[model samples]
Target: MALHNKIGKIGEDIAVKYLRQEGYYIIERNYRNKFGEIDIIAAKNNYTIFIEVKSRSSENYIELAQSLYYKQIAHLRRAAIFYFSEKNIHLSLIRFDLIALKIDPAARRIDKLKHFKNIID
Candidate 1:
């Protein structure tokens, strides 16, 4: 894999581990459709969460927040709608999330992991 891909995969693995530790049941990873791709899907407390994982080696949390654009959000929402319909899940049971990770790939460490829940609104 390319270096960036490897880094992204590692960041995703870290995000999944953190979510599992926090009692979320992982349902899917890298979910894709005609609209776009959702990096993670998990269930917790009766909610099906569609997650977008963003990783950067040097940027801080503020930069990460700015990186999530309206266009990407729109794509995610459309993809999530498709996911919920195809999976027979109710719209009311869904949540949109963004997990931003500041990782040190060489050290295999996450300097920071920010979980932004219900980000669609």
Candidate 2:
């Protein structure tokens, strides 16, 4: 894989670890449908969460936070809906989340990770 894609996968891995630590049961990773791919799909406290993971080098921390645009957020919802439809699962408590990761270039380690819950309305 390319360096950027590899870094993104690592970011997703970090995101999964963080979510598990937060008591979320992972349902899937890199779940893709007609709309797009959801980086993580997890469940916690009766809610199903669709998450987008963004990763970047430490110097681009600001870009990481702002990377998720409005259209991307809409696509997340569309993907979630498609997932529910494909699985025949009724939507009860569903939400969107965003996980941003800033990695140290030299160490290839996470310098920062932030989880934003219910990021999309």
Candidate 3:
């Protein structure tokens, strides 16, 4: 895979790990439909979280989180709506999140990981 794709996959893994650590049950990963794909779907304590992951090898060169543009956000929103409607979910609350990851291939470690909650409508 290309470096970016690899980084993104790593980011998704990290996000899943972190969410599980936080007591969130992973509902799905890479959930896809006609609209688009959601990187992660999690549920806990009556709340559902829809996550978008962005990863970069080196943020010193380019920030990873900034890659999620307006159009991307729009698609995510559309996908979330579709998911809720298709699942017939009527939950107490729902949230959107962005998981930003920076990986160091040389070190074989994560340089940084940031979770931004409520990132979308």
Which has the greatest lDDT? 1
lDDT by residue (tens digit), candidate 2, 1-121: 7888878878888888889998999999999888999988999999999888999874566566678888987888899999999999996899888888897645768898877778877
Model 1 Cα lDDT, one tens digit per residue, 21-110: 999999999999999999999999999899999888888954786688999999999999999888876658788988999999999899
Off by over 4 Å in 3: 60-62
Quickly count the clashes in candidate 2: 0
lDDT of each: 0.90, 0.85, 0.84
lDDT for position 53 in model 1 = 90
User: Which window of ten consecutive residues has the lowest lDDT sum in model 2?
Assistant: 57-66
Query: Candidate 3 on 1-120: residue-level lDDT in tens?
Result: 987777778778877998899899999999999999999999987889999988778674236557789999899989999999999987769899888877776565678888888877
Q: Is candidate 2 or candidate 3 better by TM-score?
A: 2
Instruction: Order the candidate numbers by lDDT, best to worst.
Output: 1, 2, 3
TM-score of every candidate: 0.94, 0.91, 0.89
Q: How many clashes does each candidate structure show, in the order listed? A: 0, 0, 0
lDDT, residue 35, candidate 3? 94
TM accuracy, model 1: 0.94
